[model samples]
Target: MVSLTRISEYVAQTANIIGGVLELDVLIVDRSLRIIGDSDLASVSEEECIRKDSILAKVMAEKEQIILSSKEHNAGCASCLQRNLCMVEMIIGIPIFFESKILGSIGIIANTLYDKEKMINNQENYLKFIDRMIELLTNRLKEEQALEEISLLKKRMEVVLDSIDDFLVLVSRDGEILQTNLNFKNIFKRKKPKYLNEVLCADVVDQLLNDSEEVKFKEVKVNKIHDFLLSSKPVIVDQKDHGALLSFKSIKDVAVEMNELYTHSMDVVFDDLVGESPQINMVKERIKQIASSSSTVLIDGETGTGKEVIARLIHNTSTRSNAPFVAINCSAIPEDLMESELFGYEEGAFSGAKKGGKIGKFQLASGGTIFLDEIGEMALHLQSKLLRVLQERQVNKIGGLESTEVDVRILAATNKRLEDLVKQGRFREDLYYRLKVIPITSPPLRERKDDIRLLVDYFISYYASRIGKDINGISDNAMGILMEHPWKGNVRELRNVIEFSINMSTGDMITQTSLPFDLVHPTQEYDEDLNIEVVTQRLIEKALIKYGDSTIAKEMAAKSLGISVATLYRKMKELDLKNSIG
Candidate 1:
């Protein structure tokens, strides 16, 4: 007989293998007469096995071997209800027995009269062999089923561990690393280390393990950067310690939430910028080339393109790295107060001046760099003063008699086209030329789609650590969606999307369902944004209010908006603003 191997489904595989070796075709059925396994020839006569009055069913109900010899087939052929369709002249059905109970039945069909006499002569021997085969197959199937269940359980446990935000490590009693979650691997950026000390915070791990008392949730600084609470529990097997389960929480989050720290200053090394794209390499090379220069640099890109990050990199690599790098948003400050904020006011200089003269951003950044973000938004009068400061490398604080001699390098950034602003007489032409001495434009995220995968991994690791979730990675489908997105908000939008996904995800891997509603249904979000038509109408109303309500004023407003008078008139009519304008 042919050998039997384990099958995935709950069925006997031995019957078909045995049939292949013997001339007799075989069919195996369960208690309900469900055909579980059949030989090649038996497959053609499948209808014969499952019938209520079938030989296999009769054998199963009788719990004994039933043989239809040639004499029995010929003598009772007319009376048998299935005689017309029955092809076998002689057939034997043996009940499959396990632990004194009937499991099912296995049928063997003889092809010739000579074979039928051979089957009848060896009926007792066949019964004993069939009983042994059934017993062996039953035991084998039970073992395989148990193993399959255990495998599934282990998989489920791993998935649960991966979803946790904290660093989780399973270490043997001998201090060997057994397993670890993505959060732990992300910080070290390596595969699981053989030894615990090689990857974990050595000091924290040592303290937690060596401590005699329970040391759960003990706060410690890992690698002098991450503040984490270490928790360790002994995995007792048979009342003996088998291993340890180590988990950690980020105490840095608690510090921020409790208002113990207002801001965190992470060292922005060039290596921290994660991208291998040629565009990013070029930007890195440019930063290196101009790091030591004192010339004013103009950084330009859409919002969230990391303009401020590049500016900081320049300051960190410069000769004045030890000095302060002051940054100010030119547009964020009120127009009336921007001048005083940039150049400190003397005591009694304004209605509410400080008791002593305050050091302005220029004086504060002396011997260093002052980053002027949104510099294009500076008022015309302030631009002229700023131009003089850049030229002379000194600052004359507001309401101060003597000019304060300062040595500061100015680095300005803007999303607007300063050249267009200059042509429109909104920005000073001279100032634009001065700031663009060493211009660098940061590439938008969409332009660097090749880097999206790298960036996504970085963001997943970063936000997962921050929020204390155990997100290990993203699904392939989710990453594809991210790469395809236009990323209008650039890197900032990508970061937000990742953060949103990490929070919403219920599993270790960020799946499609974890994506934000707006991202999942982008058209709906687009339509929602399009519903802001009132913003455009409000802009037209403000322009008319500032100029005048007359046709002449409307012409001037249209010129400022870079649109023709007729277009403006048509838009006003379309927006139902014909009566509102004077």
Candidate 2:
């Protein structure tokens, strides 16, 4: 191994091995750029050899190995007529290395008398081929080492699971308790279980065996002392009947773990919401109240208000916390595919349908909450379908004849006023009433202006960690501007503004300069934003004065505007001008 460090020794040692099987002379070289070693042979002498002079020197200089096949091409071999009788038709050579880092060269010189057929067939001439063999051996060694390390890890994990106080049970296919790390022996103390056939409880194992071979298993709701909490996963591998892994844990511990996972998985949390005013506190209180309820919830807020955050908070605090809480924006879905997305169709239900059918939002959230965002944007047609499902407590697939009973609790959030929509014939009044059963409204960020500092500080630290920098907090001047801004886009807008500020921040502080140009210099034209009532009053007064106190003014106003006289009368009543003369 030490000698092989230089190319010269490696070539000599390798050549010696080949020489034992075949008649050939060989030489090796080290990167010393010197002749470290060589095979002392009969057809070659140290004094007559082309070693130190320049043959190997040229190979090193060019970063490539040299091959001399015929004595005719070599002036040195040409003089020695033994070349014509040489065995090799031509010598083949290649460079040697590991991971692109070159080591050295290995070469064999055969007499013209050597076997012609065998020389061409043997890869013994290419030094790179030998390097490849070394690599394969290295990989195999690594794989074996990895397998050993994994075995050690599994053993250590087993020990750790055993040390915990919870009921950690690992079961097998034949109804055997392969391993029980929990205090099951002390808790149950069963001579047998109530079901019998229960191997853990010896007496019940016989009855369970009568059912036949165990193909599948489930580990659910196993308790330690009582129902603190637990996470169980069945070992479903490659169609094999492995058992399950059941664990016992506290509810608080699960929450902590989930919070940890959120830090790693989700970029933002409830803290990213910008609001601290009493109105915002009221929204939080409503959310807290809604969290404990198992009934349907309807969250109403303006477009920019954070309805999505309220839904997330509800999900996080609810009884179905372990199940997935999926959100689907009804407005974002394309009309044609919306039905299939909500109530999945079987394969071939449509040309592009997937095999074995698809699971819809309700099925995906079987035991969880489904938040339908922008619910009012759903077509007037789908509203009826949704209403049917809500009323019957079931959903039928797009093409399926049978209905699936889903235990999902619905949470529909919308910015649009459904009550107004119902009156305009854009939404069904019956469906609107059903959805508005437990209404909760989120106030706009401007209304909750007090939350500005809390949100800004949260975002600064949040984005700082995300960007791997230290943006300590928002500056006092920056905070004041943030509080004063009208935040028309509400919490969503505030998040964007804060994110923009943090991105522009330097030396651990954010300032006004970081704000977008439009935000700093708003270009709102006051003329375009006309007061509806003032416009109506001016038109009314002019019409009344022009027509000389006639009732025709109201009729003319309604007719010209393409509205009913009754609607115009209602508007006048609202403005206290129902039957007034100019």
Candidate with top TM-score is 2
Candidate 2 — worst ten consecutive residues by lDDT sum? 215-224
- Tens-place lDDT digits, model 1, residues 1-582: 111224413344577665765556778887767777777633323343376767788787888977777535444455678766766767778887655677788888887777677778887877777777677777876676678789889888888888987888888877787888878777766444688676457655565456423455554445445646677787778877667888877643332332223212733779666688888888899989987788899998888999988888888898867666778899899999888878877656888875534556676566677899998889999999999998887777778877767778899999876775775688999989999999998888888889888889999999999999999999988888887788999989999999999999999999999998778767833444555667677778777755555668789988887789998888899999977753
lDDT of each: 0.76, 0.62
Where is model 1 more than 4 Å wrong at Cα? Answer: 1-266, 524-582
TM-score of 1: 0.47
Residue-level lDDT tens digits of model 2 in 196-312: 134233422332233323322211122222323333455668976465654545333443454446433433245544466788778777777777777788898887787887777
Q: Whole-model lDDT, candidate 2?
A: 0.62
- Over 4 Å off in model 2, which ranges? 1-274, 527-582
Q: Cα lDDT for residue 91, model 1? A: 78
